[model samples]
Target: MGKITISQKGSRTIYRVNRRIVCYRDGHKYCVGKPSSGSTNIEFDALSENIAHERCIEICERRIYADMKYQNPVAYNAHKVLNALA
Candidate 1:
């Protein structure tokens, strides 16, 4: 199981998704460390307001579910929904 962490960078607070020992940042929401099939940097910027925090939560939750996709069908389907939302 991987852990998601929240840390402060100067005055800005950033989120990190640690999956398989790889640390992924908020602005860079792609996981290049695991599942090496496809990894693309996801942009999480909002002009209206700071949507980074929300995106980080969504992404991390989706990933956590995705990691356990095989064992639990419910969580897998829920992961699909979250993936769609994200």
Candidate 2:
């Protein structure tokens, strides 16, 4: 999995993969990389924030679900959720 970073410049936010330029804008969420020359930058601050936050929540949920699965394998099927979280 690639690491994600968020940066803010003036009113714009940039999302990068490793350190190479990806996308820039005035929001928290953006496409993971740079657009082709002459292309417009895409901003998804709300979606980005939602995805980031949802991943965090899914992490916690996975832990709990894992414990339950271990305690009673037949009663839980959290692998799907955990995979989605990842």
Candidate 3:
């Protein structure tokens, strides 16, 4: 049920979810696309590849949670409450 993938794109390594580019590596730096409407991207220079991948996953999950909150506020709050109880 997961749709994430990592692959090389010429000199840069790219991370994607469902074919949409989410993060990338260029030279010695890893870059993750912001989950907002801003035009800026996050870059990590000292992180390992695995860490960068995890960051990408975190950002993607945040975006999904934001969408869920916007589309169904009641369900989102219920889910949050359930998680908090656990």
Candidate 4:
């Protein structure tokens, strides 16, 4: 994970993570980070930068977890079972 940053691209103010544009913030309307393949971009109104970043992180984590579960269900289940046992 990388730090979220605010940068200016022409007249647009966008958020980046490790040089990758993740979110676009224009006034009160905030666009969440890039979604996984086949998913549409998420947009919301009236959000602060911190709130947007938090949302972005949450989305990213969900995508990662979903991908992991799909790609390696055995490992994912094992991890979950271990966590439950712990």
Candidate 5:
């Protein structure tokens, strides 16, 4: 897999997976929350739903202005959670 880019869209941040965008709203939306200020990598594919939920919670708790550099942690974490659910 490749890296997913998280971008700001108004008050919420979006994750770019392949060509699809995932958010935290709606029933189908697996991951939701404000992304780290800079960038972060999440090991989504290897994470569990519980882990994903924890990661999302962590992201939600993060300061909006804090700088994040890796994307694997969030991406892979989400991927794992979503994959298990799917």
Candidate 6:
């Protein structure tokens, strides 16, 4: 069974895979975290849909940021998340 799904609402793309939720809102530069449990707030782990795997690109950037340095964390993280989809 597939746990992933994509939806559109007024030019927004919503992604849901199991307990994780990712939303690319209109005019938003990056992925913003929203409460998948539908309570109040969401945790950091929910973001990126878990691209933190050892072979994932997210891990690459994270390591680079630690070694070299990162200029923009928001855009950097977003790029990693979106890149995994690509």
Clashing pairs in 6: none
What are the per-model C-alpha RMSD values against the true structure? 12.0, 10.5, 12.3, 12.7, 16.8, 13.0
Predicted candidate 3 versus true structure: per-residue lDDT over 1-86, tens digit per residue: 55776777454566655324545433233354334434333442223344556765666667778989999999999989999999
Candidate 3 to native Cα RMSD, angstroms: 12.3
Give lDDT tens digits, candidate 6, residues 1-86: 44877766554566766654455543332343343556443454444434322223344445666544366778777776887999
For each candidate, the alpha-carbon lDDT, in order, equals 0.48, 0.51, 0.58, 0.56, 0.47, 0.51
The residue pairs that clash in candidate 1, if any, are none
Question: Each prediction's TM-score against the native?
Answer: 0.31, 0.32, 0.48, 0.43, 0.26, 0.30
Give per-residue CA lDDT, model 1, range 1-86, as digits (tens).
Answer: 45766656443454445522222444435322333314433322121113443455567776666668867988788767987999
lDDT of 5: 0.47
| CA lDDT, candidate 5, residue 36 | 39
Candidates arranged by lDDT, highest first:
3, 4, 2, 6, 1, 5
Q: Model 3: how far is 46 from its true place, Å?
A: 12
Who is ahead in lDDT, 2 or 3? 3
Query: Residue 33 error for model 3, in Å?
Result: 14
Please identify which of the two predictions, 1 or 6, would achieve the higher TM-score against the true structure.
Answer: 1
Model 1's alpha-carbon lDDT is 0.48
Clashing pairs in 3: none
Candidate 4 per-residue lDDT over residues 1-86, each given as its tens digit: 98777766543466656424545433323454343434433442223334555665566666667888999999989978997999
